[model samples]
Target: MSETATAEAAYYEHTLTHRPLDPVSRYTPHPGLAQITSKLLTLPAEIRARIYHHAFQGNRVAVTSVRGCYCGSVATGPYRDDLNWMLKLPRWGELSYEVRRAFIGEALWEIHCEKAFEAFVARFRYLSNGNDALLRQVRHIKVNVFEIIRESWLVETNVFGPALRSITFGPWQKGWTIDVPNAVESPDELSDEKLMVRVTHAINTKHGYGFLKEAWEKGRVQRGGWKALFLFPIRYHVKQKDGKKRWQMQTWRADLDEGVIEKDWKDVHLVQEATLD
Candidate 1:
């Protein structure tokens, strides 16, 4: 993508959306370093700034963890991955549509699971031609992945609903990708398992869902003396399923090392790692 276009779109999304830019490196870099140290030195400030700018340029939305839960399956439950389909949209318009449809299907799936303890979810279905007749019976859904630190995949979509063809849902097949400045968390800190749980609660509850949802509805980010960036509300569903329904928020399998390394909601234990290919 053109840097100019990226910057413009990013400016709109950041400034207009009041999305927070990732923090600058708190640790100052040495002005000059020996040849060997060069490899370890941070990128120049101007360059780093540009990199930060570009990282969140297009189709990049913030993610956070599930609220009020510890254990959820990482792969199937609530989690998120960067939308990698944006790059392909402008080139193959039809392909973009399909990707977006798939996205909606995934999102719808999450909505179903969030609203009820569903035993099964319909397959995220889409057609090569964006056919409404053929898609009449297909279901689409989405689950959000909330990013707290540098990491993502905390909240995820795991359910589906019937597909639609209007613009409201036309983009259903278009794909998505997230462009985060960096992985907020990394290297799995196992030494402080207890502390990690506390931290998780703080992020998932205090800053994750509550804030973003308001932001989306308000269409602007509110600033405050105590508030920081990347705070917003999360989407939740409270619908009927299998002729039975009750409110139960989805959970995630959080791993300190892998960052949602895996999830298993029924047990309510966010393990340290996930077992996925």
Candidate 2:
């Protein structure tokens, strides 16, 4: 071969053997590191649930009636220290739904009074902007039912009815005693439907017109009627074994017994007329 051609062939062989690395491939993440950075959605559902539960444990939201109006605020750091850290998670929007479900579903909502409960509902509606997605996630609520005389219309509202799974009826006075028996003496013996009837009867006896049958009628006449009668299929039991008779009522979404409620409604009206007479 000619000297010039020989030199050119040698240059071509060197170029072919020592090609520069692609810039993108050079910066690619390690396979192990990519596996280590797996997303929350990639984890098993049970594991993700545990993570969400741990992240929001011990968090609380207090809704109090201040000057006859309601104000809702998150508990301070001592009570909800995890809140800040949870909010600071990377790519918040990606996990917003799961995070919110965990946060609201687990937190205890302390509503100081009936007024506070009403205000909380109003504020929740306003914040929701006509969407009940956030509200529906609520599972627990504590409210003072000692002076709830006007009727618990809000509890049966379409937006709040199915959302609340637990309702606690507590005394307004700090040290007052509620002399009420457990509606559920034996869970295995009594069906949910029977427990609901017992609890409804107890509440009606305790606070006449509080969970009134007339409220259902009025509600039906309003813009949007209630979904069920008396937050049906509820199981009631007392809490705080140390002599504080705070009744905690747990409800399930089941078919309501309209025939029973209608009969009770008639009975309530007759009693009211007799009292007036």
Candidate 3:
């Protein structure tokens, strides 16, 4: 090596011991090493994901978990010598879910199960699309479900009452690669009748026939918060399943209200995505 260049390199390496750490390493990074670190968040997510993908060759498992009791599953009829009854996901759980949904509709949410963890959920996690924003926010991980829809147009339909398309689940850390169905030109190509059957089946499977009927009656997330068993706000529409229902997205207006109000009800659990190879 050239003397001037070698001396300069030696001096730079010597000074490195005295220099303090870079400031961009806090909220995003764990310090100490000269090697690659978390502060790499400064780079674009796509780029970082590519780096991770290349380095790991996609072998790393993305895991998450959520804790909450399935409301209907809890014991009710029996009791100890004292004759105590049991209830779960009461006012506190209901109110907490509603408040979170009302204020941050897009944010990922989970109902904390108070029941025994053995039979009920403790957490949920899924593969991330390299969306660091959600990974940073989600505190828990792990999942499963009642219904699985294969409709193309359903992707564009509102999750609650035909108000929005592309429902959001977890900004899961190491997110599951979900295959969200594509929007088709004609929903008629898909069977509306069959979809209804699945809906009925999913409801029955998750909640009993009796609870299903009650949810059908209440029919609104805000009002039906009480009806939510494992989840919140069971809703049912009496009108015939409109196969031709015009699609709509969630919106808010303040024509008279002092603050922004929810124009459409949203369900966090009911909406989901799948991983297709």
Candidate 4:
């Protein structure tokens, strides 16, 4: 776990709302809700685990990395209206509430991608009571990057860092493959990944997200023109060429703790992994 740039500062500004002294009073449990919770708790432990397992296992969710407080133009992309919105998780608060409610009902924490998890944590960090009760309940927030910029996701996870979880970067797209830049070659000196994963890892664990500014400044010279400066790190601007290239839709099942991420061909695949600088 590495410290954020803010950690270097003695203190923080733009403070978050603090929990009231009588924080217990904040939650007025509904009688109906309490009754239901009580009834569920009364069920056998094995039965309860099964119920939770059913809720999370293999559920397909649309993933989004919300770098901004609000989703703005890209408000979580597309989700199926079906499944009673079971796992679409369009809003950060909905997912956060879902996490807290599930944990309070029965200690189940379904894992999520790094971006989704950080989005949840970022949304609720200030009010976290002791034990990180909400965060602990988080297993993973499955991400479907949805043709988004690579830097967008990187900035998201860095906002929270290891204050979050394993991130399982890409069962969505081969964990972290989406963000790792294909343009650069790794010098012999440093060897995390030949691409952006290692750079992102360093910025996250060592220097903090601020490294993006420095990184972009260093590389902007190589970028083509003003348009590139406006979107310095977003590598995918125009869609692919060659009539053979077309979007290949993928289906997914949620893998539990195995943390499987598969490769989808992209810039990194253009060259052999062996020859990568």
Candidate 5:
């Protein structure tokens, strides 16, 4: 058959191997907890796939010319949360839209996404090993399930930038199993909280997360007092550039109001696809 079909079949075969058929019989064997978690994540995975399919299939401009690491149009519904978190990635920040798309590729990359889940599981295992004693006895960490939901859900946006030159779609390692250390206590230095903060800061600064200095500068000319009146929130603030500090966010509210951005601002971007439930 076609290469796409062959690839798709291989992907499914791999998934089945990881997640054995449920309701094990004499002929079937039970899978591990890690396998179970991997399957659970597939719910979101399928939802994300549909978004990509719709966008690429429709051949929408917003999907093709997006500025940042995101592919397809604005995500809607359940997929919004996943898209938001991706935008916040430090590696994504470093990548332009073209580079990001190349990394993700056009076809389904279940294996690549699986590797991310695997890494997350490994980290979770590390924490669980340390708190195993407390977790075994405790029933609940908090009361509000909604709060948990809110914390995990984040919104994302896609903006077009430079393209990537080379792409690697797999994890740093492949098919490696992590073993929790025998020590009863976990290292405080392995905290993910600090890792996330540092990653986010790096992305924001390195990728020009907040605003485009070049765009703002070009947008500010030939306006009388009108330009100054508009870009109030985005003043000529100093930001690091090329290992040295420089003026960024130079435009004001007035610059945006009657400034360089296309008149049909809404039409400039499009919502391509989304998933919520």
Candidate 6:
């Protein structure tokens, strides 16, 4: 089998082992909560799923370090009251598995720094007691680029699990900068897209590539574990368009193939555009 196929097969196998409970089994209520739980479960599977999505949809969670301790909090989107009530329901343990699966699967987890990333992983391992079931449910993440660059061990670590479908590198604060090898322009002066292009190139430079290659060769990273690598940085700012100021964020997806970073702007996408206050 091709490497991509092999990696995909591994992921498929992993998913099967941690598949979420079906609606019928999931709705089986705990002792005291039978009335409400049974009523909800009696609904069609599709309806139950819709309810789960509505409660957790668009949830953006941020993981950051404060006073040297790592913590997570809701960064955006409403924290639905229904979801809160569900958590406090009788024998929540009986329903927590499916609820957590939906919540983590749908939320976008954002990690702010390298240390916070480490803390997040460590906390997950500690809380889950090394089981990757919860990690596998995490489908989306928005993290600092430095986390990936410094923690290249993630390339081989099972910490992220096989279900991670999207990894966005940044929404770096304006004016943040990084040193790029062989770059003539100052990072501060470059536009966000251009700066990200340089940063991507840095990842492919001899030193950067060498570290990744060393890790793979040393068996620290699984061979063909990753299918493809792309970094999407979210940039927020104000721009003058049509003689009016507007809030906008530009994003670019750069693919890394065979240790080379492909800098293509054709994939640039504008997100969260709105009027600036």
- Top lDDT: which candidate number? 6
Give each model's whole-structure lDDT. Answer: 0.28, 0.44, 0.26, 0.31, 0.25, 0.47
lDDT of 5 at 108: 23
Give per-residue lDDT, candidate 3, residue 150. 23
TM-score of each: 0.19, 0.45, 0.22, 0.32, 0.16, 0.48
Measured over all alpha carbons after superposition, the RMSD of each candidate to the real structure, in angstroms, is 22.5, 26.6, 24.4, 17.6, 25.0, 15.2
List runs of model 4 lying over 4 Å from the truth: 1-39, 60-119, 142-166, 170-277
Query: For residues 64-166, what per-residue lDDT tens digits would candidate 1 score against the true structure?
Result: 1233222122322332233332323444455345435434332222221122212222111333343333334223222332333222222222111123211
Give the worst 10-residue stretch by lDDT in candidate 4.
Answer: 268-277
Weakest 10 consecutive residues, lDDT, candidate 2?
268-277
RMSD of 5: 25.0
Residues 53-128 of candidate 6 have per-residue lDDT tens digits of 8877655565665433213212221222323445555544545556667777877665655566676676666657
Q: How accurate is candidate 6 locally (lDDT)?
A: 0.47
lDDT by residue (96-127, candidate 5, tens digit) is 23223422333222112222323323333454
Question: What's model 2's lDDT at 11?
Answer: 34
- Give residue 199's lDDT in candidate 1 (0 to 100): 34
Q: State each candidate's clash count.
A: 65, 0, 29, 11, 23, 0
Q: What is the alpha-carbon lDDT of model 2 when measured against the actual structure?
A: 0.44
Q: Over the stretch 109-220, how does candidate 2's per-residue lDDT look in tens digits?
A: 6565456666667666665686666777776654444434554333443555455544433333222222225534554424545645554554456543364444434443
